[model samples]
Target: MGRKAIYTRVYNQLRYEILSGEIAIGSPLPPERKLAEQLGVSRNTIVRAYSELEAEGFIVSRMGSGRYVEALHPAPSHAQTHWGKQASGKLAAAPSHMAELLSVTDTYPNTINFAHGDGGKHTLESSCFSDYVKSTAEQLHSYYFTSVQGLPELRERLVAWMDMEPISSPEQVVITSGSQEGLYLITSLLARPGDLVVTEMPTYFGSLQLFQSLGVQIIPVPMDANGMRIDVLEGILARYRPRFLYTVPTYHNPTGWTMSLDRRKKLLALSERYQLPIVEDDAYRHLHLDAEPPPSLKSMDRTGNVIYLNTFSKLLFPGLRVGWVAANRSFARLLTRMKELSITTNTLGQLALAAYLRDDALRPHLQEVRKQYAEQAAIMAGHLDRFRPLGIRYERPAGGFYFWVSLPEEINPRQLMTECLQQGVSFTCGDMFLLREAEQPYIRLCFTHERTDQIDRGMKIIDHVLQSRKELLS
Candidate 1:
């Protein structure tokens, strides 16, 4: 065959081997001359084929050393059907109630969605993320699959970025598709059917979804302004012997409460007493408005009981879908294997994130986000305070982008949500975050996505609805 045909043949062969995991991650490919001799093709054909593979993110080259099979390939066991029956039985059921609530889109015509946690600033020029993307494109030729635990260099840099001492080794960290995936992996590995999983009442809706999917019995404990009620948690732990207690101790999702330092200590004490693992979800930990963020539970754990899950979706951009888990080495290994069975995350995205983390641009960008979110949150809170009727109550959040508003007993938030949607304002009903069917006339309003004018307009419409209802009552 001609050189062109030969090149195509060699390229496809390498591609299949890489995808099938016959060539392991980080393994070196034969030199161009050696490969040419083995295939009985010219060195130029081998070089061309290798070049094509490299360009498509299938391989990486070291300056002096030969090209290596990029770690971008899927793990060897993904194609195996051995786990299919188990997975089918486990995941066949529909998602939990909270999951269904999260899936509901707020894209009604003319409606303003204050429901999402994302920033509303969509202009490419306004986002510092554009810089990360530009930098990633520049290094596209060299990008490759990161280690299962993620790139060591990126983890090391993350250590510095998070203001913590470096981990002893990279093997203790497992890079996940997102914090959601990290939670799922941890729950699947540590929890069994009928095992009790503890969490704050009205905790992150996504965590409830994960635990439900794994068939774990949820034990919801109540929380006050200081965060999860440690006294109540102690009593529950003594009774239930839960496998793990999941929490967002800082800037909690729906309540927007931060745990006090004393409560944090008490939580660690409870962990020690019960020997229950703490799955600390720090998804919003970085979006602090007032001061430097609190030390992560993983960082504070001396007995190795805390499994920390963090993500880039809040601090950086949501679309990246990159996060990591810091846990004991044993658990990390199981998570890595589990990830192999699941669909591998986007290799290109991981590489770009690694580059972004390494570029030292995150700190200033985060500072800008914190400032903007703080301003926007304050604006929304002011409008709510001024417009909301006497029966409504809300606590100003210390950090993060959400405000949980508790409405009057007379007003049904579910019905109000529907009416508000008609008025072009959208927010999540509070029942969406609860585990049981307990009713609370509340809703979560996110101030991050809308402009000041939009927030003002939305609140005015909601007030109009409330006033109109009051007039009918009179």
Candidate 2:
């Protein structure tokens, strides 16, 4: 077996032995060399597995003696039927990696975090926001539910702010809880269970989870440096008809590669020819570091086939939970009607965000994030220079929060992440963004959520882990 396979197998077997009471509590485990020889693996592999067990509190090492198993008081087993057999298929379709994703972004107790998907988390919090939120709520003397279509004033403000002429208007907008809700609404409207939809291979994992939960089968189209390969898309289109095509396009999530203008235009031409509906998720459009990207796919469409979704989360903050969909008035109206299935959108958030935009806060905020995030990205790039010699590959993004790196074949991605976590750094593995797991390792590091100081610490720990793993393989 390979190192990863052998290590995992040995670790799991030892754990099972302990849990099954075969390896009694407080008993001394076999020495490293003995275990390695018995398992037909290298001593380093045995050491790695034992180190994990020690870190997880399954065993402990004595001063000069050897490792011994610790007492693990098992929880009392309850006699009741398991829930899986009775659960719906959609619930079963929900993937397990989401729990891992949450550990990095939400639950993990890490010293430095680079796995958070959202940016502006640190920069956007303030007493000023608190005051604005309070004032907005105070101005609403009576408790009235926001419309299903969202607060009218917010919709009007969004139309003016977007500045997409001719095609966009207040009536063409449907306010949503977040861009995520917009994705759900679009999927519900256009696609059904067992339906196929086209997406970039390494697209946003969040979207992949949602689609799978809704019983949608994804047909992933591979991407290149310039973004999704149009030629492959054409072949897919010729073979099977997907309900819609979803893309991040500008400063795409996970990969951070923007679609070239030429490809964007070609994609539009193909969309018109195939009559394909495209979902333009413009979450990071305003977060560029250098030059501005080309116009959004929605702005170029005259056929009204593109459903454009935008969020204030990336620009302002995620907790604000305000986003919108811009489509033709007819489609927008349908979305608004469908939204009645859920409760009215958060009115306080809508009113507060509209007021913030009314004060013209967006322009200055954009400029500020552009500068702050650019510096953060540069700091990470400088630190990542150490890995280039180790066959790590990445291109610093022009904009967006993540750095997508393809790691050397010598390293095991899951093992690397676990060891790095033990050293107090966290980042998302690349397989999380795909429809399936990957053989060669890839990872997405988000820089905008952490400051320059934390970036230095996180990258240094990652560098150390990479070097150690490389040596072990050697």
Candidate 3:
């Protein structure tokens, strides 16, 4: 056989052994002359094979010692494939802080988990959700396929209740599996790789992760209580041409700060001037504890720039993964096509929610939920006085599931999280929501998921941990 063929054969064998774990990492490979003699090949063939392995990062050569296995694998040669080397990076990059963020930190004792946005728990008080599901299921039409836009009945129902005035026609809506899919569709389609997009700093981590996975650059604008700083956004728009701007305007996630009406007007003005499209995620809009939130961007928009995304899951059913996008006729049609390409439709969820809405059951049920959440928010807030003494400051959220609390820089948020978890308590650390994970002096607390008593218990535990952390400092 040719010398090239002999070296190539040796290279393949070594590569297989390293990848299969037979050649353990850090173990020394046989010396070149020894390996050549054992395999009945020339020393030059062994040298060539070892060079191949070293270049691929499967092994490393150390002077005076010998070549040792450095890695079983190297960076993917095919970024397109989705297996061993084929798959995992795109999905794996999502929510890297899931253990600390999602409250699945493997604590043995019963944990008061505050990591997830449990819209599911809030709906336990719901009365007629099951009835509508049963009724809708009994009908054969509910089982049949609907339009790419969604069921006409469902779209019509959404139009009637949508806070936005732009949704005057069913043709202007596209039903998605959930608002999350709406985000994915919008971001993936509008912003290609290497393109820039704008987002609020400490915004939804899901969007941050999605953008990073897609190789999209995020221009994070810091927000105040009034919402996305229009002044900063104005500068960003002037400087960099982003594909779109994403905001959770009403009763925002992580931090329950709503955008003021004045800021909303200014934002729309900017959008009009620059012709930038806005993707407004209004998931928590219906959870207002007191007066209704200011008019949504879509509602205030005169120009067809705002693409409104909302979900029914948070309303009265968490498992009900039905959501819709309200946009201009042109954008709506494009989103409909995107939906068709991604997820066809959630027919059963749409049918059930539509039937429930048709009966006008949502309004009363929402009021009850608002009251329940308000009470829960208060219960959690009542404990804040205890936390304030420990360098922990938090604003009592008027609506939404979270209280974006600020901890002291002196204290590490992850350490606090670790101590809390050891004591059967769990909450999201602040850094999880940032574009870059660091020791951020903020933590997000959810009050709507647990019962009032559980919420109270969790707070006491957190307070105790904070006190301990503070005492240690002194």
Top TM-score hit = 2
Cα error, candidate 3, residue 227 (Å): 0.9
141-184 per-residue lDDT for model 2 (tens digits)? 32578788988888899888888874556889999888989999
Instruction: List candidate 2 stretches off by more than 4 Å.
Output: 1-87, 96-99, 105-107, 126-128, 141-143
| lDDT, model 2, position 339 | 89
After superposing candidate 1, which stretches have Cα over 4 Å from the reference? Answer: 1-89, 92-110, 122-125, 138-144
Error of 3 at 28 (Å): 50
In order of listing, the candidates' clash counts read 0, 0, 5
Q: Name the Cα RMSD for model 2.
A: 12.9
**lDDT for residue 404 in candidate 2, whole number 0-100:** 90
Model 2: weakest 10-residue lDDT segment is 71-80
Best by lDDT: 2
- lDDT agreement of model 1 with the native: 0.74
**Whole-model lDDT per candidate:** 0.74, 0.80, 0.78
Instruction: List the pairs of residues colliding in candidate 2.
Output: none
Q: What is the Cα-based lDDT of residue 314 in candidate 2?
A: 86
lDDT of 3 by residue, 248-284 (tens): 9888877889899999999999999999999999888
By lDDT, the candidates rank as 2, 3, 1
Q: What does candidate 1 score on TM?
A: 0.77
